[model samples]
Target: MAVVCSKADWFVTSCSTTLVALNRKQSGEPFVFDCSKAEKKPKESDGDNKSAGEGSEEKDSDRILAFAISASGKHVVLTDDHKRLVLFCTEPSWKCISTRWVVRRCTSLAFTQAEDEVFVADKSGDVYSFSILEPQKVGELKLGHLSMLLDVTLSPDDKYIITADRDEKIRVSFRRSPYNIQAFCLGHTEFVSSLLVPAGHPDWLLSGSGDGTVKVWHYETGRRLHSVDLRKFGLDSENTEKRFAVSRIISSPDGQHVAVQCEGFPSVQLFAVDCGTEGLLNPADTLTLPLSPWDVTFDSQNQLWVLLESEDMNVLLYQHFEQHWRLCDSECPELKRITDALQTQWHLFKDSVELESRFKHLYKVNFDNMASYLQKKQERLDMENKKRAAANGTKPNKKSKTESGAVPHSTS
Candidate 1:
């Protein structure tokens, strides 16, 4: 079994047979839940309305909350708490291809564009590159960072590997036979949270830091290009609170819009970068997603996918989020049902002395104008859901059929 504490005050656990979530005060007993309930249809009932046989367990149930896409975009990699990595497809028909186990905690993972190789980093600052086709170690890079590797990305040409460290450094190295250090990019004074290699940009490297700044570097020359001080944009500076961890940074496939995911309230900011000046100008758009999002991913259709732990990594699409948010705000009786259950679960583990006051504080009480918003949102979502359900037959969700505004490409 694997357990993780969530920001929403719940403990999520998963085993071979089930995924369970427990309120922090639930006396350490987790309530069994089904992750697939949000998706697939239930099994047909028996003659007397009885349930069918047990459901299959999630293959990657014990994996950490991280996500990975394959080089050819055909497969994805998932790693569990036990240090075992599983390879699967990117589609809903996820089929595991292979699995490997490491001796230490897995820090980061990357797959080559060819889908032929896989790279994994461990807490010990050692990176191992292996062949996905052959499933054998091909190369290993050792850096003396002493801290855990935070993120890793392969250059567009697949000839170099870049890794961010907890020590606030970006290490660049060649990817071939004599994989040696190319250069070290340094600027941030705190831990580097993430690294991105924008597609079609061979010389550019993007790094986000715990110091509340996102820096762009000239990878080959190790020259600092642009520094975006997130503090100036209203990020919390307190070290104890996670307000601006720069959890994720991703470039749209076309290399036009770069989406940066930050901690605290879980908002995604889309930025337009000017390559001529090598700096970030302003955000083209911004979206406030559900709170305490564990992972965010963009699908092949450019639609965003969010994974939350309300009941075992709830996967909600970005388009459905506004309506989903509305439901939790007001109107929907389901909101009351969810909150009541959560409160009861919390009180079960909390000290009764201050339970009443704590319940009022923890439970969501923001209902001012929420009712009006939910009313409007319900209509909008009903129209949308019906339209999508019609074409999709209640299966995969459909994105907007009409084209959106053109995204201007950013030059290298």
Candidate 2:
């Protein structure tokens, strides 16, 4: 829901019907631009004759799907489910520079290395390029995959455009000449959900997928350098056929560490990037969380921010100090406010019946560990009580009471 700028000083987040920009250093009201208000007025037609309440409900359904901030942190772009793309300028003033309609709803967006052009990927398996310099022209068709795209990124030097799709394929194509196919990184067995070209190693690309593994690949040579099975950490007993997908993978801005999170697990695995090593990656640490995280990203300070998937939608911050990561007591007020607003909007828009149907399994009791935990706790309490009773010189009660003097004589 929020994308931090490469500089780490600014981030742009979609809050309800508005796109807001906040500075990491400053802490006042964020510059807000309401997308609902900025939307172009509908033309007069029979649709206008519909009930006002119905029209309002339709407008509220146009929620933002994807948003991105430029490397310079000055430009921002976001698209909603209504097939509208809006570009904004973060500096000087938070203002919508261009608002255009696209052919399909965008699944992801990224700013080119030059920051003059933006690439938008849609569910229809097409990518569109819109020029910020030439705002008058429409978005031009770019290369696309046959399957729906899940994520898109441009090489740091802007030579290749790498994209991940639902068909477990990561395609690297020439940015200038998209028709020319580069190489395909095809090891993933399921949908590739996330991709990243770390700042330190532009040649190597990191990806997370529905296969429950995070793989490092040489995008140019199509060689997989390393693969980590996340399932081993917390899903050893799960069915091998059932997917425990890696939902998000993010590298710190310094490129020294990468965070990997799975769909159902509440732990984030951290790996240190070793460009010189044969494996190219080493397990650095793991952060256990209270709830499964929906997304994770590092701030400008190299601290981690995790967005929770629960109904509260809490955003947690973890700071790295003394070579260890710990939860920060201080909070990002701006991020907190944005997430609160998002949760409210989510409740309003979410369909309870559909959600229940989709996540019925989650509601079911699967307390495989809870029973063991309670058993261990009871054992510990019993031991403590025995120690206390022994220290107080208390005798244990017997099932058979002494039968007066006859029982005492038999003992003698």
Candidate 3:
């Protein structure tokens, strides 16, 4: 299922072939972008037939893969399975700025600190930089990894372009000189699924991995600071390694707190950054989810927003009151309006989330080769015994124990 991707005041949710964005500051209608309705257009530069406006057939796989809201919150970008990178401008009104194409289906997209350039990370392990100023321009190959990249983000100063991959490594490189390697954040035993440079903490980086822990890092130096194991906070019955991978890591606007969500798990683990040590992760609270969460984010007001698997009450808002998160689902009418608008295509959201559990295969499976080999050897010996008994003229009752219901001995 598609997850809700948000930054600042605007929170957006995408499903199969469409996306909905709403500004919390206004009661205006949510902007709906449907790939099925997007018409393919010719690029002015190379006449490449990409799409921007609506009304044309798209692929069945043309679902939104990743999206990002500019740090300034004025621009929004999302990549779809159709290899189309769609951009939107929020001010003056929500408008489609351009439709560009990526070399491969993107796994993550991020706007630089300046929002002048957007980086696209694809399954091919390559990142392409697209120009926001020159919306019609094609992307330039930036840098790449040896394995599929799952998440990409820029340092707060836009000095470093950090990327995490399925091979369990986070590479930090110079944004201007992509080949200038800064450092690598290593330690995750499984695929890294999400990355974030928390607000107000430029030197610090937070990453979530399939191994079930979120690690804090100093991006420039590649120093590991702290880590949080989400399994310790999930539902008691759901503490197995299978429910581990940290799917999303979000910081409150003030950067005082960070929230971590595990895929297919029913809890959001909150952490207080720099609470005890200067640069450390401290467990604060675990927001018990009634259902598995799709994503979590903190709006400009520091209110926590959670998108769940349920269609009836798809979005929930929480306020940090008295050192704990208090529910405001029925109290916030603005959020209520957004939830009502999403209810129509809510099934799409549900279906999108169901498809996201594809990571379970990333774990290793077990097999015993020795047991099978020993059993075959014993069967061969029994066959020879049966033949010798037939030639010795022994009664058929002495059938070499071949026809008997005797259990075979298993060796350690």
Candidate 4:
């Protein structure tokens, strides 16, 4: 899938197996790193890990499953479909520092506040911690959940490790002792898909879920600050059979603006974060794109960068001017070059994402057993009432209630 995110002057985007990073200081030159050609550290390749990490590049061998740039924007780490944990340095130059192995296929990646450690969360409900200072060292198991983890993030000060799962729960655990959970930000009725602890707001945490709502929580206390229902804005699920899923939630570098992207929708919803103590959410404006978006993010300059579905000229830069967003793709000199680079492998992203079913089995299938049981009980009551009247040698009245005061069953 195509994805874009930025911190400070660094602009990073990924498609298929290649991640392109463009620093404003290094204009016209985007650092493109392909994971297929990556090499493991010295003597790190052992016998047990030879099958997944070491192999000839097959179809979808190097496809990036999850990736994240560090808080300082100086490093990036990504896990591929082949179970390789690849880390890159960004400040001096975009270079792959390490390619480690994960026990299971990773679902999400996160960096500590110091950016010295990288956290890898897999679909098997386990999270592994890898050292950034010691790139060649193996990873250590940090924590695990009972259900599949969808997103992982840390508090601004690195005090707590927050994780969301397939079971509609957000767990806050101590970073030093993950087994000791701090709190759980509960109330989402479906799987939590994305999480964001906005910049400049250490106490606030923003979460998006398949329940079609965006909620704000005070991470330390696990108190819900506020919530916004996307359905009120007419942002329903494209699949009528399923509930709406908030695919991504991103914030501007200043945390003054938050944008929400729903799965299967071609539009982006923007929310203005208040300056008050509660940091309330107010609807700003919803911008509809021409095509479905693979991902969206905000640049450090507070401009929204949208990676659309189209292959050619897929990158769009929307400038917020005069209280509304205006198209200014031409003004961005790096867009054409980035689009040109992505065009070659656009089909790979399109084909792979199209075939992947993200939210197929998430909806709950409820059986109303109470109603069925009550119906059967009433029928039994009527049958017994009739038998008693027949034994008494008298016609039973249809409206007569039994000694138990149960209503007669309707047979129509």
| C-alpha positional error of residue 364 in candidate 4 after TM-score superposition, expressed in Å | 2.8
Q: Name the lDDT value of residue 201 in candidate 1.
A: 64
The predictions' CA RMSDs to the true structure, in order, are 26.0, 15.6, 5.5, 6.4
Runs of candidate 1 with Cα error greater than 4 angstroms are: 1-65, 89-93, 136-144, 177-179, 237-243, 279-281, 308-412
Model 1: lDDT to the true structure: 0.56
Cα TM-score per model = 0.58, 0.75, 0.85, 0.82
Q: Write the per-residue lDDT of candidate 3 for residues 176-282, one digit (tens) a residue.
A: 99999999999988888899998888888899888878888887888898877665664345436344677888998798888888777777888877755756887
In TM-score terms, which candidate is top? 3
> Can you write out model 4's per-residue Cα lDDT over 176-258, one digit (the tens) per residue?
99999989999999999999998778889999998888999988888999999898776764544547689899888777889
Q: How far out, in Å, is residue 387 in model 2?
A: 79
Model 3: residue 188 alpha-carbon error in angstroms: 1.0
lDDT of 2: 0.72
User: Candidates sorted by lDDT, descending order?
Assistant: 4, 3, 2, 1
lDDT (10s digit) by residue, model 1, range 40-153 = 222342221122222224122343534355644566555544445556543433345656555455767888877787788766677776667865343454443566777888
- The reply for model 2, stretches above 4 Å from the true place, is 1-7, 41-60, 235-241, 309-313, 331-412
Question: Which 10-residue span in candidate 1 carries the lowest summed lDDT?
Answer: 352-361
Clash number by candidate, in order: 2, 0, 3, 0
Error of 1 at 191 (Å): 0.7
- C-alpha lDDT values of all predictions: 0.56, 0.72, 0.80, 0.81
